[model samples]
Target: MTLTIEGFDHRRVPVADGVSLNAAVGGSGSPVVLLHGFPQTHLMWRHVAADLAADHTVIAPDLRGYGASDKPADPDGRAYSKRTMAADVVALARALGHERFALAGHDRGALVALRAGLDHPDTVTHLASLDVLPTLDMWDVMRGASAAVGFHLYLMAQPPGLPEQMISASADAFFGSFLDGWANDPAAIPSDVRAEYLKASREAVPSIVADYRASASVDVEHDTADREAGNRLQMPVTVLQQDWGAALGYDAAALWEAWAADLEHTTVTSGHFMAEESPAAVVKALRALMAR
Candidate 1:
């Protein structure tokens, strides 16, 4: 019943609210669930997951709206909220026999992990977020042309239908833009892996847009509520970012400290895609966090 890298199997797990997720399981130690960034799949963790598999059971899943997972049409704008997605992770882990496990997310997945910490504190032992800010702080920091780096965030945050329609019109370009710009070294992403990412994202445009749209609205509400309540992540938290704030007009560490109680914030000089660009650094950071 144990899964390993050489013999890994991907399965579709059904969670509450009729959403099913594609999850890959491997390794055999302390459970560590991994969530990937936008326009990417669980595949984002391919390198980091292998390294962690040496001492931790790694569970990487395509979020509800991405990859090979079920993309149920969003009717009320509720489907793509991080809270709902966080619930999916919680349910998915429980179904896999992990009542409590460490959780880490990159990009969009990091927001999901933050929500998981807020909504299901007892279930997530530790939280790790790579290259992202909380939903509220993200929006708060956006202003004028300076926010051009995250143009997609503003575009996707618009009213649901338009964004999805436009993105679906040219899936390759839309997804490829982030893939190219976010990574410091595009060559680091193998051609085959890049192709696979574009293919998967092309098909999941609608669901992906909806997921981003939620962040501007419902996700913001949840984040604001937690912030106003002075709620901090109850578990140990680790944040690794590319020093975007200094270059783009904000303080990364200060922003993160507002949410995490016990935190280890490190600014990485590597590309935005830290996992692939600097897997060893990523592994070292995660290990240090896990040890704490």
Candidate 2:
């Protein structure tokens, strides 16, 4: 069966620089934009988005290079940089008639949300990140053996050509590896959604690699400058992770504290894909974040 987010109206919203993003808009109260991570598309938020739609206008989009959205490749990888991606979502919300909105992101989308808060504090009311650390702290905390687990990070970070080719060579296996490995409960991702994710991932190899490549280079630069300037997210920020701190031997909360002035840090039980593996808990957390 073809998977779809029920009740949401899908549209291709044009943002800046002649780009159009595929977004699913639903619900009716305060706007809350939902972002998905790597190896998955906006479909990752079906459960949470549907639940939140009851009380919030949920806008779930395929980040520029992922899902059914436009993919524009850049030689410097700047186009896929978190800064640009953040701008896309901010523009996306604005075009949808929301000047300011609540933001929640999982994985790559979370990184974009972090940048959005840093760059557009006045626009993003609340920020919630699922299973990720700030780009700078992420590179900092991930050292020695802990880094090995993210071999894909290093692989995709290299100069463009090769990483794209290699992953594209075996896209399904490459994408499926994460879908299988990360979820504490494999059944949390239904077969049709899994198929959709794999199909999207396979078709988005180069653009996806560019997204990761930006993280290791330009993203780090953007994050480092913010940290050096003593800038932190002015809005309320909450983070939910799988307690990688214990395994990686760093205080995840303390690291996140450095970036967020008002932080609500919680360790989740659902591996990396918390939204899908445990949607109720994820929805409850976001609801609480917005409430605060």
Candidate 3:
């Protein structure tokens, strides 16, 4: 069975503390929440979500401050933290009558999914992460030549308003920059979809930067606390990463195991935008995770 974006019902659902989230939901069977990466909105999951909706109840939401979701100012950087974002998902699920569900996330969303599993393990039964390492390991692994693989990490981590202001100046180009740099074949992403990502990200510039900016500060602190507390994700985990080792000279699978105990990690031959670049692969991986 194939699902199309047109099949889903889109609505703004209230979550926590009077905050509301814009979500795209469809299909039936077990629920699976799809979370997208940075600089892209829930639109990133259009293809995969539709496919999964054929089998499972698929819920794709624009993270708290991105896409059409309310962009509450990140006063004190709390709104952008993964902990808060995870809570939004938890509340959104409960509101939708799903106290427990399968959760999958890519890029920034993957981080949120990770936090959700760790912080709220009883709620997330199965977890899938695409194209990212845990926050602390991701920060710790950069060394020498491999450092170039994630220069944006440092660029966005700068103190205060600089990164946010610079990115907001020409938000279209700033957000679209990853599309050009990360894809092995830029043509892999349909031009219309690419435009949609840039358009939504460009509009949500301040909140988007605040999301990345939190990764540099409080996110690190949270990851440190998790590490010290020895709270590894107890749920079944499936991680799909690009082969950064061959090009960047280090194994990514090893790094991921440090964070997840029951993990099945592998590298996809496609680009960083795995879901967009190769939807079939993403679908297969998710199907495997669902089976697990």
Candidate 4:
């Protein structure tokens, strides 16, 4: 059986025409939507969601083109762009009776949350991004040998057929490699959860590749346009990231300051999959962001 957040109720929320997100929602006071990263599902937010549900309405959903969410074909490439995915998130919240709420995301979801905060400032009251940089800055900073760490990014960024076919040929090995290598404590993600991630990713290879492909193309265009227009995240923002800058030769905080007026950036000791490996710290940071 698939594992779920203990007390949260699962439902399909229609965020767009013929597109419904599989969301696990619970708690009360204020709403906070949690987004998962690549090679994972909303289940990645299991621990954090349960704790936040104690005081906040936590909505954790499998992103469009991921997990159990509807995987619409990306014939136009715009289908999986962060702009479109951000709209899905806003629509999800409004459909759940929230006109304004805190938004948080890990990995790929972080990209979505950043876009949402930029595109719908009034709706996202607070924003938290776990372990990722905005699309444009991300591409800019990755260079030389350090760029090797993001080989998958370049691989998936290739035109449609090749990346999908390559990943699909050995889906488990491809997706499982990240789940194993990126975690500081592999045990943090138990066997069952790891299996779930691999299974979901294996089944959604094309859509997942499309999501990343968009990040390299259209997502970069959107962020570039926003930067040129001097558009920034209008809400309070909290960023928790590993000390990637120290090795990658970029000031993570300085880069983020360019986009957020109210910013709190911290370098976490946890690995890339911090949400699962360091839930207490993740929860603490999120609570602090919401309290701001």
Candidate 5:
């Protein structure tokens, strides 16, 4: 079955050089772009998007290299870097006549949103990240046994050939594990969305791994330079994450403080897919952040 969110108009919007993002746009008022995470599409915001659309223009897009978005091949893997992906979102919004927009992301999308804030502070009016730590803190807290549940991160961080090959061989099981495991209620995803996710992952193996590969290399370097230079998110930054720090023995909020000057850090009981598991909380947080 063809999966879609009601009240959203899907578009292949041009953004950055050599790329266009597949976005679902709806509603009016100030623009708000919602980005999807790994193993899922913008449909994850089905409930929240419509609600926000009543008050804001909601632009939900499959990040480059995922869903129906155009994936450009670039050497050195810089193309898939979060910095590049973030730029895609900013440009896409600008093309839609929004010079600045309220931006929110879940999981991998959060990483892209993080970069958008740093790289284009003037473009992103407010920033909300769901269920993820900033890249630097994420690597730091993955010490000792904290890395156990994040085996996929380690696997995809390796040199491309093997991870891509192995995952492609069993795409359904690989992606299904996260879709099932990370949700507070697995039924929140439903079966058709699950099938769409598996299909997208199967078709985009190399590009998907490239996104992760860039995270381990170029993405990290970009983040480190920003940190070393004492650069922080200039806007009101709200980070909504699962309490992985509690289980991993770290202060997730404190770690975020280092990167965000004006910060609202929160830990929710929902699993990794907080937007799906707890739409009301996600919507409330976003409305507050966008209020800034």
Candidate 6:
């Protein structure tokens, strides 16, 4: 009855001292890890993962604090930071017998993949980020009236109590709004999968808020430090994004080029949930990135 990536074997792989990630892995040959974004699970990768599995081993995991993954408490706000999350990805891959692999992510997962590429260059052979900018660039660009579009970011960035309380008060409405509003094709996420996303988000309010909260705080500090030290992704990177630049008054590709020397940035026509909305295009772009 549960929706899942068909043909993939699911496991709870230990990645930290006491935390583990719920991963769905399939296929063989070179490995490719896919990370899901907010309000969704590895199920988001069902279409793309199935296609990729024909040749490349595809491992799609629900990131920490989301879906069926362990939600460790964030007593000091460091628990859900992208750095910590990125580390989990590395450890997960290694535990699954992969010392090096291609990495790709969508939304929040893209942010994690970016950090992993920056922090562990030799381990990630190639990188792809879907529909997200880096943490520092993200905060830098959201200004004036256009910033209002990301009201949820500001809301979840608030200190622990209020954000969790308000979101929990009406979890379905809060999480469902994005699912309903952000997709170009609503049928891309059918009723069962949408129900699953809403259910997972409804139960993980505090941890989800902590994940977003870190982006506004500790994640920014880490990104700022990296920028100051001139740290960059030392691998081929591909970024697929919607044309948020024209509307927000900034160049997305130029911004990504600063962090990656070998970068291919493409503006996608699909909605924010591009992997589901345009799986063939996503698969093609990822295959090209891996080839490079």
Number of clashes recorded per candidate: 0, 0, 0, 0, 0, 0
Task: Order candidates by lDDT, high to low.
Answer: 6, 4, 2, 5, 1, 3
Candidate 2 per-residue lDDT over residues 141-193, each given as its tens digit: 77897789889999999997899889988999999999999989999897888
Model 1 misplaced stretches (Cα beyond 4 Å): 1-6
Each prediction's Cα lDDT score? 0.88, 0.92, 0.86, 0.95, 0.89, 0.95
Q: How high is each candidate's TM-score?
A: 0.96, 0.98, 0.94, 0.99, 0.97, 0.99
Better of 4 and 5 by lDDT: 4
TM-score of 3: 0.94
Query: Where is model 5 more than 4 Å wrong at Cα?
Result: none
Q: For model 1, how does the per-residue alpha-carbon lDDT over 70-139 read when each residue is reduced to its tens digit?
A: 8988899989899999999999999999999999999999999999999999999999999999988888
Q: Candidate 1 vs candidate 4: which has greater TM-score?
A: 4
Badly placed stretches (over 4 Å) of model 6 are none
RMSD of each: 2.5, 0.9, 2.7, 0.6, 1.1, 0.6
- Candidate closer to the true structure by lDDT (higher is better), 2 or 6: 6
lDDT for 99 in candidate 6 is 98
**Per-residue lDDT value at 277 in model 3:** 85
Q: Give residue 27's error in model 1 in angstroms.
A: 0.7
